[model samples]
Target: MDDITRDLVTLRDYWRYAISRFNKADLSYGHGTSTAGDDAAFLLLDSLDLPIDALDPFLDARLLPSERKLLAERIETRVTTRKPSAYLTGRSYIQGVRFHVDERVIVPRSHIGEILFREYLGELGSSFLPDPMAVESAVDICTGSGCLAVLAAKFFPQAEVDAVDLSGDALEVAKLNLAEHEVEQQVSLHEGDLFAPLAGRTYDLIITNPPYVDHEALDGYPPEYRAEPRLAHDGGVDGLDLVRRILDEAAAHLNPGGGMICEIGSGREILEEEYPHLDFVWLETASSQDAVFWLSAEALGVE
Candidate 1:
């Protein structure tokens, strides 16, 4: 608590100091947008007495003495413990959409957010397959916190979204995120491995950010990996375990002319070498990730 005014001011000042120290650590092997310091501040702010929306306004105002101290404690706990700020706060954001997350699901950081939110995908004017009246239905296979599924629904309001995951806990978190956006009724949460719950259903688009880290890469990952679910990080020996499986099975679930897109991590080169027989287009994003690829049902040899 602050000595003069309130606890909020004290917390904010303390977090700013803690974040500086955390970011100085080595984080070369992990893929996270916010520095440790940035995360620490977020954690501190989340532990406050005010409404979540008050964060921006509070930062704009001068801090009171008491608010400073409480924030310091929050920062110290997170920085010293080496936990993610998203886990500490139970929330994370991608493309300005807030998601409820926990240890059950990896933090949402899909580069697909750039494409989906920015509407870089093809126009729906010519789309009439799923239904002439229906815009475009989508499947978020390997959906973790269901961030991409929600994004799909937002971008394609006329279409419904189905979010499928193997982890029940992760789906629970995903359900909350879908509901938070008032699209819970629109999104169907299915529990099963990728494309398993999908069965004979077809979609205009299938998206995934499946586990694609090679065993060696996982072994050498920075300390940040220790905080995330290993199931979401380890992609087997060559990192193509899940990617290959997805590519092989996804074609069966896509409508004719429909495609599947996945974030393949560093396995892009290996995939190219392994699947020279297939035709796929690897999409480039402003996020600078190179492994995202899309394959049509016909190109992948699926009926």
Candidate 2:
């Protein structure tokens, strides 16, 4: 080991080194972290088997020689491979719940997670779906990694969740997570295109974070993003290919007074323009102001 690496005996020292290396490498952040320091902390803390959140307590803790070597190797891989930290660690958390992740699925980083945990889906969510607790059945379409489906189960304890994804590989990862979260009984995994396997099964709430990345945007995504399954990110030419289909078909699958919550990233304006007749209530989260939308069955004109 080099002198600097050898000197990184304490967690604090290694954390500093990780941050410096991550910044110097110009790594893209979007998987689970938005900054180099946060990524470094995740890698460092996870490598040492320390709690990611309780960093202050373990900051001064010193690492053994073996531990330092493993950590150094992980940092080196992160800088050189441009892989997402989640892939490096083989674990990811959404709303404090842990899930297994790999190249088979995209990292769970949806704003809907925040809405589910908060139990209040912003003003628009409240107005569209007044009582989330009353939802008896929920469906999560395009359920990559099943993180959102698991969260929906936890949020709506009274509801049964159906997580649908087309990719068998992606569904396998979701299965692992659903089993890990012990929601297999409540969250059913389906392998089929959106709403195909869900035929004749109506839901009180439908939520999806479908692929909304336009062709141009998909091309611009960093290597870390490209590492994930293309089906999870490609939304066709306008990024609304799936969104358009969902809007047309979702109404038939929603029960009376039911609502749908969908995340479209930056397709809000396009959605409004495409369907000028329908009213979409844009919901805001801590990080985004107009990435997700809420629409009641009535608003969607479901019979």
Candidate 3:
């Protein structure tokens, strides 16, 4: 770190050094980034309060002594502590939408964001959703930092969103994000189990990325994943406990023509085996084919 302070003057220099250290440390990623290079760049840009995506412009810019010290500490901490970079910086992004985060919530990286983008803009437009404009109400179960709730509010600007979470700590973090995105008026936050806080409150659409990591997997998770709240990841014996609850109740909460989209991690097989009577429309994203699923109220057998 002392050598880095004297030698690394530009963001580019720090970027190279950070990547080297991150790769050598064999740190696990996937909190808004997937690789060593991306992780290094995200943390470096975030530490300097620079545009996370606009790194090229500032690569050559020199850093102050204060800035260098902060970067050094952050870089070392990321390698040694195994705490996710998002927790270190207190921020994360889903499809370029930023949200504040800490140990209180899992860093927002659900495939639902990709699907929501498609529902409104991609070729799949109106496939998962017939008309975004017609949607008057929606809910985001396991809202965490409320990233999906914010996206839902944007995608369906006319809809009122109710976001639910069992953790008051997570809901508190979500409060900051709701205010940060200025969707405070459109999205309401509730603290309770999935759909528990929204009893009798039906909606035109429902979205959830609940805790779906089974206990077996949770035990083998590296320090980076384990650092997060166990309540956010433990999905019971099969990682589908919360998902099943949402699936069982979502149709009742949705309008007859409405639908639900859920991210179940890798539980597609488990779900199919359990619910053989229903067809789960698996949605494909850049990284995975079975990570998310969609089913309309009619499919869920709602009248």
Candidate lDDT values, in order = 0.71, 0.87, 0.90
- Please count the clashing residue pairs in each candidate, in the order shown: 16, 0, 0
Ranked by lDDT, the better of candidates 1 and 2 is 2
10 residues in a row with least lDDT, candidate 3: 121-130
Which candidate wins on lDDT? 3
C-alpha-based local distance difference test score of model 1: 0.71
CA shift of 263, model 3, Å: 0.4
Cα TM-score of candidate 1: 0.83
lDDT of 2 by residue, 172-254 (tens): 99989888888989999999999999889999999999999999988888888888888999999989999999999998899
lDDT of 3 at 30: 76
lDDT-superior candidate, 1 or 3:
3
Per TM-score, the best of the predicted structures is 3
TM for every model, in the order presented, reads 0.83, 0.94, 0.96
For model 3, name the residue pairs that clash: none
Q: Model 3, 190-239: lDDT tens per residue?
A: 99988888889999889899999888998899889989999999999989
Q: 187-292 in candidate 1: lDDT tens per residue?
A: 8999998888877888877889998888888887655567788888878998889888987777677776666768887677788788898886767777565767
RMSD of every candidate to native, in Å, equals: 4.1, 2.1, 1.4
